[model samples]
Target chain A: MDPFRKAIKGYDHDRIPVWFMRQAGRYLPSYMKYRQRMGIEEMMSSPDVIVDVTHDPVDRIGVDAAIIFADITTPLSGMGLRVRFLDSVGPVVENNIEKSGISAVEEFDPSSFSHPVLKAISKYRERYADPLIGFAGGPVTLLSYIISDGVDRDLFRVKRMMITEEKAYQAVMTRLTDMIIEFARMQISAGVDAFQIFDSWAGYLSPGEYEHFVKPYVYDILQELSGSIPTIYFSTMTSSYVADMDLPADFYSIDWRIDMKRFSAEIPDEKGIQGNLDPAIVNYDYALHEASKIVEAASGRDRYIFNTGHGLLPSTDPEKLKRLVEYVHSVNL
Target chain B: MDPFRKAIKGYDHDRIPVWFMRQAGRYLPSYMKYRQRMGIEEMMSSPDVIVDVTHDPVDRIGVDAAIIFADITTPLSGMGLRVRFLDSVGPVVENNIEKSGISAVEEFDPSSFSHPVLKAISKYRERYADPLIGFAGGPVTLLSYIISDGVDRDLFRVKRMMITEEKAYQAVMTRLTDMIIEFARMQISAGVDAFQIFDSWAGYLSPGEYEHFVKPYVYDILQELSGSIPTIYFSTMTSSYVADMDLPADFYSIDWRIDMKRFSAEIPDEKGIQGNLDPAIVNYDYALHEASKIVEAASGRDRYIFNTGHGLLPSTDPEKLKRLVEYVHSVNL
Candidate 1:
């Protein structure tokens, strides 16, 4: 088995499986140059360029896994949601999840996400035999972004819709969760080995709502995908509920807020664990030093994946990331 | 003794001391009318207006204590360091902490504070005869706003300066800590009953840096205000470190990220707790239903202060808020 698979499974590995959340992002000089030479819009428009950017980190840094180069909203984009990536504002979706009637939204089906995304995932996988992780947004976070039509500070619009226009929001979530489960299932069937359900905005949900609104939807997705591929339920700024969150995720990816050593004790033994480091700390000179400290912080845990509490910031230099990969490899005693 | 006062002292009260974090803001029709009549500039400028807004929830909603009405950067405006409060942008600054040479920064000349603010503190003591609380920005968080000149998605400039411009950043923190200690101390001198240190951005710091750069400054602020009045340390989005983080503050004003009952056990018995409710939960009836469940979740805890994990959003309606407040007070054990 691949070392990355071994690490995610908590089995012995030759070295720590190292991969970054946004390794395909703007931080790499080559990624920027690739943008200039290859044309900015061309990369996202073509499967080849997307896959090239996806594998760039692996070649540049020798990372153990290659996450497919795609945004969480790409599926929605295929479903007629126009998205504009702003330098400062992130994604700007002109159209939203809320249409006047269900019939109007039915025209924009998520099943339409096939040719462009599948091709890109396939090409990215071909570039490496290592663990290639595919990702999709969980129901709550996905709908929150869609309805807001862009990046929101607190997903206020989502909460408003969840309260005032709930049937519409649940309609969207039902569609999205069905799409996501299928989305992850297709990736696993398409030869992608591991998957992550990124609940990027899970901090927005309350415990009661988490149990009712979010849990069943996510559990359905995970349970359906169970045994086929490892599924990581990861959310930043959220450690309030996971020990007994009752999710069906095969592994939990956490932020630095929870003590991972105690977290391993809290969650069931059958479940694998990853992360809890502050990603911004990677920008520190003591990157290796802090990574080691974080590793030691999770020392008593049996199965663990080394990752940051959140995704990489746009300001992070890719070189430090390259150094982090090499460093984690050396220190995984 | 007031339950709020008793709660602060880690004493048993029949009920938890409950107060919404942004108790006095937009939720009230009276507040909107007051802000409209007074204007934001006038609302902040007039001590009489400030005192009125601070007292509205205390008078109307009957919350536990009155936190002083002012923004964190209001004192910077006092210092002639440029700051702005945009309608949508929250607080903005012309000069950041990095450039605001701490060594050159004079000791807080009490004369610099607006006349109304001082008078407001006095009036809250004289007129209301209730427990009044005061606040100051934790050094790093204020410095972050200073460096960014506004609220930034990531405090990269602040983080980068901490690494690159170490001496300058340290001097800024050292001076800010001194000013905060004095500012907090002045509130006591001005007759405020309790103080809170707002580390809104401290969640951005890594545990290592949080322990070193941030905690010491926090310790100094808490230590300087020690025995004068009880102090609380509030961090937004800090669920990962709920159990392990150790700052010298007397209370942890936590967010929705940590479990309320489990969280109560994590903090030392000597310290009190302020919150664990998700403000977003108030939007949905299910969320509202769950919000009440969160109060029950903490039913057995001692020395707890009931509050939203963070400030109430501007969109939160007063009717729902009034119900939420009544809900917390009604069933709290």
Candidate 2:
């Protein structure tokens, strides 16, 4: 078994399995070359391009895993939402759920929209034995984009809908939860070794609001996917409430806001923990020194996978990431 | 004694003293007239305009306290940094600490620069029996703007400086801490009832990083101000590790990411707790209903202060905020 799989299974390994949230992204020169040739939507649709981009970091940096080269909004296009990737502004939904309503998502065919991503996963599986991690945006996070029609820093529109229009909010959340499950199932069938649900913006909600509005759908999705594959639930700025909630995932990927030793103590030992070196530290000359501290914190744990707290920045130097991977692997358990 | 000052002293009050961060800001129609007439710097410098803007919300909304109308970067001008307030982007420092070096801050005289604000505070104290709160940006938050030259979401540049150039980072941090202490002392001397240190962006650091890089300076400022006047420390997205650190403040104002009941329980009984209604919710028709929930959670605490988790949005209706204050005030312990 691969080191990542072994670690997730709670087995002691000789070397820590290290990968990054955005290993197959703009920071890599090989990936940037493709970005110059075509738009993100075009690159995502091309299985050949996806395979090349997914393999770039694994081959070049010797990372333990290859996350599928796709956006969290990749499945939204299939859900009847017109998704566009702008220059500075991230994924925008032209006809969002707030404008188009729940009726807009009624005709979504997950298999049809997810074909490109699924195809890429299958092709990558054929080419490499390394694990291919698949992901989808969480229900509330997806709704944040869909309700606002774009990237909103405050996500007030979504919260307002939840408060004043409870029934309508539940209807949309149910549809989104179903669509996400279908998308995850398709990726599983296509041979993804692991799945991560990115509830990136869920941290913006209060614990009470999260428990009331978002947790049920997250629970439903994680319950459905648990037996099929190892599941990882990822979020940022949520450590205050995470320990109290009983999330059923094989692993939890946390941001770097809390100490790893403290977070590890709070979480149960049965589950694995991935992540949390601050992405900003990678730019410094002493990047490896900080990386070693994160490694030291996870030293005694049988179930540990090394990764960054968040996605790599666009301006990151790829050589630094390559050095980090080698450094983690060299640390003996 | 005023309810706000009474509550801060951990005394029983007839009603919960209510205030909002950015209470005197863009949300009020009266303040907008001044904003239309002058730039932020001009408005802040004109003691008469500052007094009017600061009183607008207290008179109109009936909030318990009046925070002075001034920018967090108000004292930077004295430190020899050129500050500009762009339309959408926040305060920008033309000659940032990175470009101008520690020598740029050598000639700062806090009293000379804080004259307009002190005059406004003295003017407000003569006019009202209600508490007039004063504040300055915490050392790390001030350094973030000075180092980045503008608003940077990630604050990567500041983090990089701390990692690669520890000595320079310390030198700049020491200067900022001393400046904050001096600025805060000027506010207290001007007859302000209470002081708050807005460590707004300090939440970006990990607990370990915050302890190593930022906490000592914060400790110095809080220690210096604790006896002179009631000191409140405010930061967002820092709930995860706040309970562990021994911060010496009369009040800890937190953002809405965690539960009020939980946060209140974690904090010791001697210290006061303020804040944490989601500012976004105020735009909804049911805004007061949510505000009431916050009051209910803080019902038993003698030292509790009612406030929003963060600042008010510019788009917020002033009527809703007035109604919220009424609602919170009506709640009996």
Candidate 3:
């Protein structure tokens, strides 16, 4: 069995499964070489390019799993929104979905929307022996990007809709949840071994708001996907809500702000846990030593996956990341 | 006694003390009127202007305490860095302090540095009857802005230095703590009633990293100032570190992420707890109802001060804020 599968099953393996989020992107110099030649929209929408970049970090850093190369907004284009990846500023929607525009958001049909991602997943699965992980933005997170220009710290427009137009907000969230389910199912059918749901902006909500507005949809998505394959629920900057998050996925991915041991104690042993390492540590001089501290903290915990609390930063050193993987493998688990 | 003083003293009053972070900011039209005329640097440096802007929110919104209107980076100007508040981008240093430039960081003297802020505090105290709250940036947060151009989310350079150049990082932190102590003392001596230390970026550290790299200096600042008057140690996005913080302050101001009831249960009643309504909720359509939810959560808690978890946003409606204050004061505590 693959190391990722073994770790998820809670079997005693010689080494823990390890993967860094965003491992395939800008951090790798080779990936940047290709990125310079094409725009983000073109690079992500091409199956051949997606497969190449997806395989880059695994080839260079030797991580345990290979996540498919695709942006979360890949499906948004088919949903009647024009997504643009601007410089300095990140992914922005040229046309934002207001309450009046809610009727314009069509249900994302997997066959028509994001066919390139599915094709890339199918192609990459044939090439790589390691577990192929699939991912999509959580429903509310994707809604945040579509309704607002991009993921906002304040989430002003998102919350205003949630407050002022409750019916419309629910309709959009429900549709997005259905869309994510369809998207994840398509990736799973394409031979992806596991799935990760990235709820990056869920931290902006109050616990009450999260429970009322966000949790049910998240629970529904995990429930739909859990029986099919291992599902990882990753929410950044939402550590305070962990104890209250009753969703039972195979793995819960934590951010660096919370202690791994404390987080482990809160969840059941059968469930797996991945990440909480600060990605910024790689830009520093003591990357190796700092990575070792995370390793020590995670040791002896059942089903713990070695990964960063957040995505690997754009400026991450590939050599440092390679060293980190070597060190994680060398640890006596 | 002022309502703010009553709450801090753990005394029961007719109404709870109400204040919002960034109460005197761009949200007010009156502030923008002055800001349009003079630049941010010039406005902050002028005592007459600072006094007027600081009074705007108190007069318009009817809050209890008056936080002096000044940027946390106000003293960074005196420490050999030139500060500029750009139009779109917030505060930026014209010349950011780099690792190679660490030697240039100088200790701030109250008499020599930030004299304008002290002058503003003195002038405001004479005009206002409400307890004056003075504040300065915590060592790590100020260090982050100084080393990096602004408050970086990734905190790449800050983390790198903490790992690689440990001694230089320590030197900068030590001087910053001393400088903050000196800067805050000047405000207190100038007749401010209490002090708040804003460790806004400390949430980026792991518990161990926080305890190792950030906590000691924070503990020192609060420890030194706690005897003189109430000290509020406010750190944004760091509710998970509360148990491990071990840094004693008279009141621990938390962001809206944590449950207020749970937070109050964890801390002592005599030690006041301020804050934690999500500032974004103010922008919502049902601002009053949402603000009431926060009030309900904090209803029975002792020594609770009504305030937003973070600073009020620039687009936040002053009328909504005024109504929230009116509702908070109307509640039977």
Candidate 4:
């Protein structure tokens, strides 16, 4: 069995599955070369380039999994939204769906959407021995990108719509979840072994708000996709909602705020756990020391995956990342 | 006795002490008039201006306590750091001490430093019967500003220094705590009723890291000043550290992430609690509804202070703030 697959099942594997959240992105020299050669739109649209970039990090850093190289906002573009990745500003949506109104939010057939991503996953799977992980933004995060301005913008319209326009909010959430389910199914058919849902901004909502607005939809997606593939829920900054999170995903990928020992005790052993390493500590020596602390915390747990609390920052040195990966692989749990 | 003081003592009061964090600044039109007339530094330097701005929210909104109008970084200038406030960019430091090295850090006497702020406190105390809150950024936050660029900057140097340069880190933390003690004493001497230490960035560290690097120094400051004045520790982000916090403060002013009911149950009733309405909810009706939830969460506790989870956003309307304040004041419980 694949090391990533075995680890996700809470089985003792030959080696602990180690993969950085953004191991496939800009930090690698090979990725930078492609980025410079082609604009973002061109590179993202090219399936062959996506295959190469996704494989580059796993080859260089010896990670246990190869996540498909695609932007979270790419799926939104599949729904007919005009999305652009600017130089330093990150992703920007030309036709902000929030202002366009929720009535404008229509579900698209994921089988017909984001062909490049599906093609990349298929190609990567043909070559890679490790599990190929596919991912998309959680309903709220994807919805926030198009409707609300950036993550920090007072989620005025989104929060207000959640209340005043409950029907509209429910419609958008249901449509996004359905599209997400389709997106996951497409990736699974494309030969990916796992799926991870990135709810990067779920921490912004209060528990009651999350329950009312986000949980049901997230659970709906996860419950539908559970038996098909090993589903991982990457919920950031919402450690306080641990007890309240009733999602049926196989794994919960928490951010750095959580205490792994306590989390393991609270969560059932059958469920797997990944990450909680602080990505902000950029110094190589400190990162290694912190990684050791995480390993120690996660010790004795039946299922544990080594990864960062968030993405590997652009400024993060690839060599440091390699060393961290090497260190985690060398740990004898 | 002042309602704020009575509430802090966990004594029964005629009304719940309602105050908002970041209450005095940009949200009010009267405060904006002074801001438009002079730059931030000029306005902050004028004692008469600070007094008027500090009282404007109390006069307009009828909050229980009057928080002194000042920036958390104001004291860094007293430590010889070149702190400046720019138009859109908030606070900037010309000679960022982080680059200057932690060895360059020094403690300054608050008695002779920031005369305008002290005079403002004195002036406000003479006029207002309510308790006036005096604040300083927690040691780690202040140290971060001088050493690192901003809150978002990868805390490479600070995190590294915490581990590698322990002595230097301790020196900086010790000097910061000392200076904070002096700053709080100055405010206390000027007749402010209580002190609030804003550890806005405390959420960045894990429990072990926080315990090793931050907890001791913060405890030292609060312990030293315990009897002199009611010291409130307003820690942000790290709610997991609630079980670990050993600081003896009159109140722990927590952010919105915390569940007040759980927090109150965990903490002793003799200690007061303040805060945590989410400021991001922009709709007046929604804010009031959320405020009612907070009140309910905080119900049955012997002592509770009503306030926002964080600072009031610049976009938040003064009218909504007034209504929320009015609603809290009218609550019978």
Compose the digit string of candidate 4's lDDT tens values, residues B2-85.
Answer: 667888777777677888888887878998898788888898899899989888888898888888888888887677777777
Model 2: lDDT of residue A119: 92
How are the candidates ranked when ordered by DockQ, highest leading? 2, 3, 1, 4
Model 3, which residues run further than 4 Å from truth? A98-100, A283-293, B148-153
**Residues A31-131, candidate 4, lDDT per residue (tens digit)?**
99998899878888888999988888888988888888888887876677778777777787777765576656667765567578888888877876778
lDDT of 1 by residue, A105-184 (tens): 33344355674667877776676677788999887887766665466546666666666776876787777777787778
Query: Quick one: ranking by TM-score, best first?
Result: 2, 4, 3, 1
Ranking by lDDT: 2, 3, 4, 1
What pairs collide in candidate 2? Answer: B277-B309
Model 2 chain B weakest lDDT span, ten residues long: B106-115
TM-score for candidate 3, residues paired by index: 0.95
Model 1: per-residue Cα lDDT at residue A4: 81
* Clashing pairs for predicted structure model 1, backbone only: A257-B240, A257-B241, A258-B240, B96-B146, B97-B146
Runs of candidate 1 exceeding 4 Å displacement: A37-41, A77-88, A99-104, A107-113, A163-166, A299-302, B10-12, B77-80, B98-104, B110-115, B283-288
lDDT of 2 at A256: 87
Stretches > 4 Å off in candidate 2: A285-289, B285-293
Alpha carbon deviation, residue B8, candidate 2 (Å) = 0.8
lDDT of 1 by residue, B1-333 (tens): 988888788677776677877788887777899877765767888878888889888878778889888888767654556777777777877665455555434446665564466678987788887788888887888877677646754666776777778887787787678778767766787788888877887776666667766777787788777788988889876666745667667888887766666777677777777777778656546545666656676656666788888888777766677677676777746
Better of 1 and 4 by DockQ: 1
